[model samples]
Target: MSQKTDGDIKVPSKVVVAGFISTFIEWYDFLVYGTVAALVFSQLFFPKLDAFAGTLAALSTFTVGFIARPLGGIVFGHFGDKIGRKKTLIVTLLMMAVATTGIGLLPTYDQIGIWAPIMLVVFRFFQGVSVGGEWGGVALLLMEKAAPSKRGFIGSWAQIGGYLGPLVGAGVLAVVTTFTTPQEFLAWGWRIPFLISILLFILGLWVRLVMGESHVFEKSKKAPVPIASLFRYDTKNVLGIMAVHGAQSLTLYIVIVFFAGFLKTGASFTAAQSTLSVVAYLIGATAASMFGGWLSDYTGRFKVVGAGLVLSILIAFPLFAAAATGNIYLVMLVTFTAGVACGLIYGPEPAYFGELFPTQYRYTGVSVGVQFGTLAAGSTAPIVGTFLLQWAGGGTWAVAAYLIGWQIIGLLGLMALGETRGKALEERPGA
Candidate 1:
């Protein structure tokens, strides 16, 4: 490893690849549940309710994972700050793998009655905690190792994994659905994706185990209580990160989780079509994230992210209207555009948030800010969107309005914070 006197460092390509793979595995474990929840959980786990209520119930359980995330952030962030990013990331990956595999093994409502859903929520909570800690650690592991000029681009490899996870998850589900009869799919196919986690876990563990800790973290003075120090010294940045992330979460999850169901129930699309739309969104998101990250290196994080939020707001109504058209290609086009817009916000996020706090508490600060933001918006987006759809007699206008509101809040949050495109990680703002 090479470090300049100005605190910039050169990270090896192998380390970046390892970080990306581990991040992909962790996110795949967490996001596979969302795909299942959208598709079959209502039928399998909440069989007793009417269709509308059942969908709501299934999505509520999905929200449980998000609800547990902040706790994961606080706990894992504590250890990550005190111990090291590499160790904490390994622990989180193990937890996620176990929890995800556990979900695969659980019996449905037909077999276990109420115990099935209860156990599902329990496993989901652990998965949430695992991922809550996973993002900040992997992000720091990459961002902290990269040269200051390349932090945004390198940090985006982690985000790319995040975007790719859903694509791969949805792809797996689409494949299983294609091979199995509807009866078989409902009976056994859904578990295949979850069960595959064990294998991915092995790969991620091997990669992460060989990777080194963040040099930037190793050089920093440790805070006795990183969370407390974070709140006391950088509360404004914390809140700003939350707002920025909250907007992106609300926008993205609405499309990822809510839109799939909307296409099925409202637009009368087939299951495969709904899944395909999500795939398109993920593809566009993944590509745009890479572009956004590279662009942020030159244009500044604030400008790119702010532009994305504004673009999201401008496209809010058009996105839903296109979905309402019931043409799969059109739906894919609009959703892909929405994904690209959201990607701009996500791509710069790791570097942007990591730059806000000193290394002493960066893990805690980033984890708490991002998780809390996700908890507030991403957690309830599907449920809230569903309720709004019902309240509006299945019209998507209300959902569009909801998205616009969050994007505006995100823009305001962007304005509240200073640009951090080229800031050195080791420099504390008020020190």
Candidate 2:
């Protein structure tokens, strides 16, 4: 066997920064859509429905992106496992830009009627496809490049965008809404956030161009058929990862995506107010993720995620009740606190998932797990929550109960997986 050297093991700092920045940029694209859906999309795209129904309709479109994610995962993850992470990432990033810019230029239902929303959905599908393919590559880039000793802490950086993306998206929407009249904002201001993605896309593209491939991926053995190998050998690993990851997705989208709109329609808060509340949740989530990373390093990845799942169960009713009270401050507090629990789970899963499969097919396994898991969890949570509210006669209690029931499934998932903490990636096969 060939011996490893310093050059083989060391990954550059610029690549790491680019990973963080580009991850932020790509995710920012998705969050902007999320922000707009919760704010102005209902009025512009589906003005005929009642306020609640229109918001529900707009949120359903948001799910379209998540639904496309698994396909993105399959396509992108395949190439990422075949080629290298960096090249495949460039493709996904560019795809994200084109899709986001199209959304910015799309005509509204007022202007084009049915054609308008159909176009928007098409662009949104592109966004989902690109982002779906994107996360696995981005996460692997970071996790594979980082020092093995600091896998939990350093790999956690892979999700910095997880915090900043929503924060920036909501902040921008809040700014545009606060400054412009509702009429002016609806007509033009809403497009500003989407358009700003062009600049972000360009910047992220440059950083990616400057960076290189993951050191571990470059040195590892290639699977003859990555995705097939993943299913053949790692079926149990894939299912376990999906359940654990899906729990976090359900928690985040239910709160950030669904609850944001619910604040506007159910809690009677204005769009700006609802957006601001989401900002609070993102801030809490981001902070919690940072802390969770540090905590996971000391404890195990599964332990940290388990605690977060437990927290989700405990806080479901209170978090929903807090949002229902129509107090923005209380809503912010509960959202932020709940987000901390989400961070705990979100922070470690990437590193944990990366460690589960062999390097020969790590990208495909994690991407498939993360993306396919979304259908059951994040993609459907908003739609499910909205209906749950309607089923309970417009009360949050049913939604809260549904959330508790959901977490129970994730808890069971956590138990199925074994610990991977401190598992070093072996560069040489059959060592």
Candidate 3:
């Protein structure tokens, strides 16, 4: 590994910036589907299904991608541990872009019958695979070049990709809907935003190809490459990491992906109103993510994360009640709170989990933890929320109870994990 010369550590290079750009594109492409599903998918693809059932079906497609994420992580993480981060990342980026573009061109249910939904599922699976491999590499690359004390801050940028990705996705949907009527928006305009994803893919691919490998992973030559061995020997860290991931994934998906859906159905908001409210929520999230990263730098990671989890637990019922009653001002207030909570929880997970393993197994460890959370938390939230809503006769209390349970579980997970906020990368395993 090359040592940084004087002043070289102060500024990130073009390649590092490119990593952020590439991650932003990857996340944006992945998140755009949820945005579309929330506003247009039910009408377009599941037109014949009942409203709640159609939503469940749409969310089911979204969860399918997440279900495929672990496989992607294992494949990419293995090669990344054995070969290198830069090359592996290039492949994931291309896969994600192509899959996203393909969805743009796919025929709708009106045109193709059952095959339309099947093909959509297939493309979504491709996206999941690509994203699974992408994040571990991107996070390591950025953090490797960061100054020792600034790892949390720099690592948080990878997370910023998650927040900002949705912002772009939702913002595009919001802007398109703001001017277009529902008939026009559903018939054609939704596809327009999806088609634009191709440009983002091309741009991301070019940037990722130019980025360099992480110095830390390169230097840890003796570190184990077998993911199973990492798990077998480091089971405790794996479990701890998975719990942290579960909390973050559940909270984020509920607030971001499901908010638009929940509002349209539960609160009976117009498409434009829901879009606008979600856009505002995302704006809060983007700011909160940056602030959370800064907070992790000054305070400990666990402290910030714990605060986020506890706050969610306390406010979940109130927030849902406000949104459920269809009070526009209260809805906005609660939505903003949920977004801020998501930002706070999400901002630290990448860095916090990344800090848990030896550099050689770092990619595998983080990816597995995150992937498990996708399975445990991400895949289940929408389905569970929908089911609860149905059983309770669309009562907002049902949704609130369901969400608060996850938050409490997350808080407990945080309490059990070791705090490694400022520990050196190399010193983390024994910290």
Best by lDDT: 1
Q: TM-scores, in order shown?
A: 0.91, 0.89, 0.87
Residue pairs clashing, model 2: none
By TM-score, the best candidate is: 1
Residues 1-431 of candidate 2: C-alpha lDDT, one tens digit per residue = 12222123455766666666666876676777776786799999989899999998897788788888899999989899889999999999888888889889989999999887788888889888888888888877877776655566666777777679766776676688789998998899989998987887887888889887876777777887788888887888888888888888898888887888888888789977787777787887788787787787779898998999999898898887787677889988888888888889888876788878787788888999888887888778887998988998998898888888878888887788778877766532431
Candidate 2, lDDT over the whole model: 0.81
- lDDT agreement with native, every candidate: 0.84, 0.81, 0.73
Worst 10 residues of 1 by lDDT: 1-10
By lDDT, the better pick of 1 and 2 is 1
TM-score (C-alpha) between model 2 and the true structure: 0.89
The lowest-lDDT stretch of 10 consecutive residues in candidate 3 is 1-10
